[model samples]
Target: MGVSDLLSLIGLFLAIIAFLDSSERKFILNKFSNRDFFLVSLYLILVNYLIFYQWWTNQIEFLNYFEFEGFPNTNTWAYFISIILIFWFLYKIMYAYFPNENKDKVLQFYKYLIAKKEYQSLFSYIEKYDFKKLRSKKVDSFQVILLEEIIGNKLFLKETASYNFFFIIELLNTNDNKVLENNFIYSQLTDQNSYTLMNIESPNQSFFKLLFHNDEFFLKSIDHNLRHNMSDLILLNKYILKFYLFTSQKKIVENTEVIENVFLKIIELKKIHILNKYFSNFSKTIVFDNNNSDSFASLFDLIVNQLNQSLIVFENNEELKFSFNIILDFSLNHYEKPYLKTKVIQSLTTKIDSENFIEFRKSLYECWRKSKKENESFNNNIIEKISNY
Candidate 1:
């Protein structure tokens, strides 16, 4: 290419490079990044025109280098070589500025690990995943963690696990709040055991998506209905995390309970209050087992038992108080025999005192009012049965 053509091409190429970064995730836009394409293309045409202009005017300067004597000071072939080198440097610049190009390769590696069921490889996959640098980069800030893959937003994971996870993604924006938007019950909207993709906007303006994928494990595969009724396992896992953390620091427990954000915090400060709550809620129990055919209820009962037993073993609170009976109802209404085998009516029986139970039932009804897509209610006889408790 001629000199004017070359400069025009270079300028255009730089402009193209600048154009691609306009997107939020600038890593893989249109799958191309060669800036010189447009620059060099336009330069070739313009440079040829410049050459013609030089010939028409009989300008010797246009045909010769002002810095050199003729076509180029160096060998004619060197001109072409320099063009190639320029392109190479341009490519280097593109890659250096936008480094997430290798993310596809990383994802391929992730696929391989997933295929092998290599759970431990997750740690390395996250660490090795190439990230495009932006304003702030920190271990706590950016992550391609499994949670994101399963549930787009709506949750964040602690570098370490904890029980209060359930309360993490609270709805601050009333407009999008599930309660106001008629997006209440989790089971009603989502398939009983599918990945839920949510984009969670954080108060800090930075957000991460989480993907919640439930496998056909013991509890989920229990029965067709039970699987659907299965409790929000991810939320429960968070609860487990908080419970363990509190129990571990029981000696300083009184000071540990402090919750300023009701939606975001599980148990608040006033250690005595939390301790009293937990003491009055769960029973001293340990019950999960490793079994292939175990249903959701069976496996969950085991986990609850183990969790309760562990809590009680630590003597952090009262053994039997709150109704894991709620969990039992969760398992029964969503899973069980006929539902898994064929179509059948499914109902769950949770034993609770009728007085406070009525209030709980009312709240449950209110939550499901928008969804559930069913108008049926417990028969009067059924209410009498529940009242017997």
Candidate 2:
């Protein structure tokens, strides 16, 4: 009826409306400024005083019921009760809304990807569904490409893809080694992945940072379980880069053109490794049908050409030896029959006649000789092909 009653009613209405609004939780603490707090406190005190005065003078029935022998002011008790009820109501409303808010769709989707073992689709999946929520403003295409390589490599290995893994590469102002080192330390605690391509002691610190620290902040912002994993593929790809492309002492000065070239080489080597892994099997030889043979043949030619070009930069014989063994393994693994095996051997002998090939040839010759000694008829044609070469 009076201004105090009107103000109290308006306050009650606002409090109830706030309780009904879902987004009020975000603003509840922010809604009260120092001025708002002082005003509300003064208003409650004034209203309580007015009620006590009116009740004492008029002897109101309901007001007299709350009287006591002690100095327990009824209007003061009423004011406290009203404030407590407002807070209790807000608390109940917020509790009901918060649990539903915590059921974040993006987080659930990431967990789903991990459980389904769809690791290779992780980057695209995030980009398609939850990019805005998960991606940092500094994220770049290189980081995404690097993540793709990390997850895609799982397809080549027997290991299960991990959900708790993060991939970070320092791309910005890579001239700073200290910054790269700091990021490396952070990535370790976060990534459950057993292997990381990050080379802390790399002499080419600048480039190492570029290759390993491109999306440091972006990666760290993502959920650790969603982001961290045993980055085997990228690490293997980095092994090729660290050993083959970045072998020079002056790699620190290598320009973008050189870095881009190295990336192309890394991609090519990955392609070769993929072909070797898919086609070569100790368990059974792949029967290259017309459907697959064309693809197989193209990958085979690409591998041979890449290996030939590798001879220029490969300083270590063991590196080329490993490459030769991969080729030999694939050649031997894909052919079960003697003629098919011999045919692969012949093709290999033509491409593999260097000094390195001779050592590899002798090793194959001994293996065949050992097999022949065990059975006297293990595959005479393969031994003959090696001997002729």
Candidate 3:
């Protein structure tokens, strides 16, 4: 190979290296705005053209080292091939720098921030803009990458007050449902130990609150986690109960199925305290009008059966006795009719066998008697009925 040919090869190799580097470190190219990208692309094109023109005019041999015995016009073919590759690289650079959609632009900017490790700036950017507008597959992909970075660095383990950890929480709080819906990101964030850490570190349960409130889809996801024993049952139940409490007040009709399904899962898990809290708040929301009365009755029956089974299973447990008393107490005191309370007591008495019924009555009676002593307004009639049973 002549020196000119060797120089040409070196130039092509440099161009290929530049393209590969730009491809791998896209954040660099993405840093340019559309105008800047166009200018840079034009400059690169001019430089490439100048080099090609010099080679063509000076009769610079193309790949002189290779013997092109069969093909008489190898030089022309090589020149065209090189031109095609150079333009292809330029096209890719353009695409990276000037994404088609706003979401893609946001995603590219986020990639730039992450690549530069400009977390503080990224946090500010996240706080400044509403990410709901950028909900897309690219955003979801970015979120997964961001979450992986947070997890890999054990950033969540940091004190919640720290900016780094706060940034993570903020990112999670602001992103769209697609981010949380990603199975990998969901599992990482909701992993038993990681979730426990987040719960402890977060103030006022903000992490869980934002997480559950942002999307009803998570209710089903959480249910699946609970069923598979992939999450902390008690912690999740607490959050779900809070979610329902807030959602019920809004009367979002769409959330009815979501609420019921999550509640049923909690019942299946037999979280007595959570169940008591949910039912106490839930009963107040029911209108009991003609439209929903039958549904309420059916749900009430299901709850009664589950509670009855729980009472049997935890017959000797004091906590269960207190939960039962609370449920009954709330049902009686809060509602004028108190028929739901009556139905619950009747279910417990009739569902259990003779021996178990006696023990349940005795436990409930003692709990009510204790509660009566603590509060003067406790009903004596219920106590008398239980004692007689």
Candidate 4:
């Protein structure tokens, strides 16, 4: 190949690399409008045509059969177009690989807004920008800077502006290291203090619904926070439970480790209300799969052990009775038939004593009666075992 042919080949190669890198690394294509795509396509076609026209005419003999009476001469523009396209491709590749320019511009704009306390404009800008079009790292940087500004100013804590902050947070990508690393941002997203700050009396079930669609992402965040001990488990455990319950209703909890981790924390904290909420929701939404018997057994044992602990620890009879009813409801609703053979009934009833033993039996019977008709055999087996106990 001649020098011109080699240069054209390199240009084509660079263009292809730029396109692919932008598509994968920067997600630049997602930001492109239809007009931008059309222009890009036209430019590529023109460049490719200039690069290959002479080669195709010379290298391939079949073109001799065509009428080239009015065709543009390759000598006129091929070398110049080839050189221009090469530089353009190089620029694109560099932009895709190192997108700091765009990120810096965005950060500067946001800083200006924050400096001027243009809270409304800042929120509008955030609302208008498509975060998915940006690289995750850029989005993460934006979140860190924005969060620092908000927390520093205490801008969003006011009753009038709190919802705006929450709304902006809802738009942010939750699966980011920077956002998670910022303790105040992490607390606002996953802690109970968020509700109090927002003046919400209860956990908003759909608060995280929009932020987390992937089960693994949500689970990993929970696991990471718990593992690092970054969160106040006492204040956040209920919100965590609420998030799990919300996710359970929307989708299956696929990662058992995260589920186990969260549950262990809840049990460790002895948040009976959260536990009751979890069991109540688990019974309704999660099916007990015999295939995952080991996991089921582990989780069951943890909860049962907690219940045994509750029996001794809880001074309030009503709280103890509430716990009993919740566990009974969960067990009877989900466990399969021949409950004695399954070891579920035995593990549950093992802690019953002469005092609340009558209450436990009554709760068990009530749960049996409340259970679905198809669960009669399972409930009957549980009741028979309890009578023998």
Candidate 5:
């Protein structure tokens, strides 16, 4: 290749680099914006064009004066067309690098914004910074303005953020790798006091601690939000049981509505994991002093009511049926108090038909009869209550 030809190739290479950098496809440099790429590419392309033009002008003059040997002069139309085609090829290759699905999605989001004419101010502010220096811990003044603009826009509603926060919480409990820890998306979700602006109830740095560090705080936050929080109550059942296992008077605030709703969530979800955790850990630990005993009584009352209300589902939901059976067996075996024992009997006897629950009923009555033999003074009234059922 001639000197001008080689220079043209260099320009094409720089243009490819610029495109890759701009589109965030370059390794490491992908985090940086396109400002430097654009500036450097413009300078190199301008200088290259000038030099090529100078060489072309000389070649043209030489051709007019006398014919030269070897390949056609760089001034020829064919040479210029070849250079343009190479640049076009480089630009077109960007689409292939992007992968069609992602490229189409980006294009669609762009097209949607174009149609709405929204985010013009945000885009202008974004253009001002190279983004390499932008930190999740602290955003610049312009970035803050952009954030405020997005917050105020009708397109981004508080409800949307609230739902998303709930999603992150659920994923934190179940998903792998402990995602959302020190992540960019997590930073965006909670940073720059954005949580407040998003109307997400999660208090700034506190949310980070809740997700990765403390189970108690996570439970209390769920208790705090209660039924008002997640759009899907069924999705919350496992967490409620987890909270019930971990929570104490110090951890959870007293709210009858919240407690009832939590029970209702459990009934709706009917998940075996929740039932297993409750039988394995909850009954053994939570009941302590008179205060906790009363609380436990109230909770058992609610469970009875919820179970009665969903008897049809209980008969069909094997997990729910098995959970009640375990609760009955545990209460009979471990419960020394006549009051808690009677409550357990009353709750279990609610399923009088026993067509589907016969095994559970038989096991429970056998345990009660066995208990009566151990102590004749053991509340004859409790056995009367069981016989009445």
Candidate 6:
């Protein structure tokens, strides 16, 4: 190939680029992938075609022409480097002479903080900012609200400021919604003391919201109410209880039956009705600690026995039977322990007060304890519990 062939090849390459740029089809096709594989396949096809073109023939041909001496010169290392330096300098000069001076670099640090849900770091750091100071900078734009992140066709101020470098900000929407809208707000610079209130309008109930700090400069004290339809609140209650029951980091308080009974009622009236689905609920959270391997399992054992006696989910549904069996199997395999034997006895004493169900649990514990004191593992204890029962 000579200078002429190279020019023709470069022209073809440029035409492909132009066609791809003008059409989304090329992106979907991904024709640029695996060029080496395509080349090898082409070579094999050409060889096969040659055999078909003329059955018996022997031929060899080689051609070469070059005017320049030492085409593969060692000096090319220094020359190519100098060429790169020259091009970089030219690009810098061009950037400096532009209308807005140099283009600002994008800050990438915000991506990690938001995506990882590193709530403590994100919220704590945002609390410290005084938005009034950041407003002074000659920034280009304030992205206080990304309209897409919240409810569709609605607005939310999810992210506002740059994490690494500052930029100018401008507010585009002043009176976007006339009705209730405020969810929260934020400050990017402040490290403490950040919250905002949004009214949660309901038929009889009310709620206030709070936001962390942010510094994108559209600093306004304007707050809005969050109105909820009946269905919305009902759905929300389910999620809130699930989150509360599973995520509450507080120590497991040793509540009396009075406390536990009240808690169950609250869960039934406020929490259970709101649940969209209970298919994924398990006795233990994914971490398998079940709050703790001790007091909590004792709690679960009591709860499951109570569930067996309840009208909550009538035991006849085959699907529910499977779910209950899973709960029992996991509890027996993971939670049975000798240490909780006396604890179970004490709990049974209180629980039996007058009900025969209490004696049932007491009997179950007797079987559970004998297996445990005999140094049975979880499986053997489960086997022993079944045999004794």
Q: Alpha carbon lDDT of residue 338, candidate 4? A: 44
**Tens-digit per-residue lDDT, 1-389, candidate 4:** 24567566868776765766321333333333455457667765766665576677788788767636787665446556656755765555434332444655555555665676666665554444533333254445555555555433344332124444455344444444333223323344433334432443265544465434545445655666676665555334445444544555323234345556765776667667766665554433334333344444444555665555454554434555666666676666556544323657555666554555554565555555555344556646566666665
lDDT of 2 by residue, 1-389 (tens): 34475477768777776775442333233334455557667766766555566655576557656455886455565565567656754554343221223334324444455565655455444333233422444534333433333323333111321222232232223223334334443443234442332332232444344444343432342224223333333333333234223333233223223223332444445444433332232111223321244333433444445454554444324434545565655555555545454445444466555655555456555544544443322245455656776
lDDT of 5 by residue, 163-260 (tens): 33443343333322232322313333323233432443223443443543444334444554453443223334433433443445433335345445
Q: Compare the candidates by lDDT and give the number of the best one.
A: 4
Q: Residue 377 of model 1: what lDDT?
A: 38
The C-alpha stretches of model 4 lying farther than 4 A from their native spots are 1-109, 115-117, 126-282, 285-291, 316-326, 333-335, 338-343, 349-389
CA RMSD for every model?
18.2, 16.3, 13.3, 15.0, 13.1, 20.4
Candidate 6 TM-score, C-alpha based: 0.28
> Best TM-score goes to which candidate?
3
Error of 4 at 387 (Å): 6.9
Candidate 1 segments whose C-alpha is farther than 4 A from its true place: 1-130, 135-228, 231-389
Question: Per-residue alpha-carbon lDDT of model 3 for 243-306, expressed as tens digits?
Answer: 4444343333344554555566665776677666655544443333213333444444444454
Q: Which stretches of candidate 6 lie over 4 Å from their true place?
A: 1-280, 290-302, 309-319, 335-389
Ranking by lDDT: 4, 3, 5, 2, 1, 6
Candidate 2, run of 10 with poorest lDDT: 281-290
RMSD score of candidate 2 (Å): 16.3
Count of backbone collisions in candidate 6: 19
User: Candidate 1's error at 297, in angstroms?
Assistant: 27
Q: What is the lDDT of residue 380 in candidate 5?
A: 52
Write out the backbone clash pairs for model 5: none
What are the clashing pairs of model 4?
none
TM values, all candidates? 0.25, 0.32, 0.42, 0.39, 0.39, 0.28
